[model samples]
Target: MNTNYHYMRFLVSPKTADALSLRQAIQNALVQTFGIVGGSIYLDILWVAEDGNEMVLRTTKEDSTKIVAAVTSASTPRISLQKESSFLPALGSTSVTLDEEDL
Candidate 1:
């Protein structure tokens, strides 16, 4: 199969507590949003910000929309998908600064 991978830039809630928890929350959210198979196949974290408030995710191009929907729909420690890019550098270049209110 020809897989077209894309990167999703996202801002995570600062109240997420810790990196491990945030990661778990993301995975749980993915599973909750897309179900077992789709979430397992599509949701993968490529990079995480130093502060753990931002991240770059990799997913199939076809599943990009669903990934975004999943992240945005998450309730606790809200995750928001900022943009999608085919290039990794492009995803990395755009910096998102978060404030207390933004989280």
Candidate 2:
């Protein structure tokens, strides 16, 4: 199976911007356009980095075509994306039992 990922990194000046709106735009695009199924925003960890900028999002593997089309035309205009490699390990080598309660 092919696993795809997308990452968007933005550089913003703190005093000259509203980070909330930017995040909203991205989140809206993810839901309305790309059809992202699940994730979380670490807002408390948002901050200016070593370059005196801030970071907001990190999404798991998603459809590349959808992701690109969604954010490319967003209002924020500052977000940029990068694709990364992800690895998954097999959980078990045998069939596992599932009880009625498990379901």
Which parts of model 2 have CA positions greater than 4 angstroms off?
1-8, 11-19, 31-56, 63-66, 82-103
lDDT of 2: 0.45
Question: Where is the poorest 10-residue window by lDDT in model 1?
Answer: 14-23
Best by lDDT: 1
Q: Candidate 2 at residue 61, lDDT?
A: 47
What TM-score should be assigned to candidate 1?
A: 0.71
Off by over 4 Å in 1: 1-3, 15-20, 95-103
How well does each candidate superpose onto the true structure, as a TM-score?
0.71, 0.38
Local distance difference test values of all predictions, in order: 0.74, 0.45
Q: Report lDDT (Cα) of residue 46, candidate 1.
A: 71
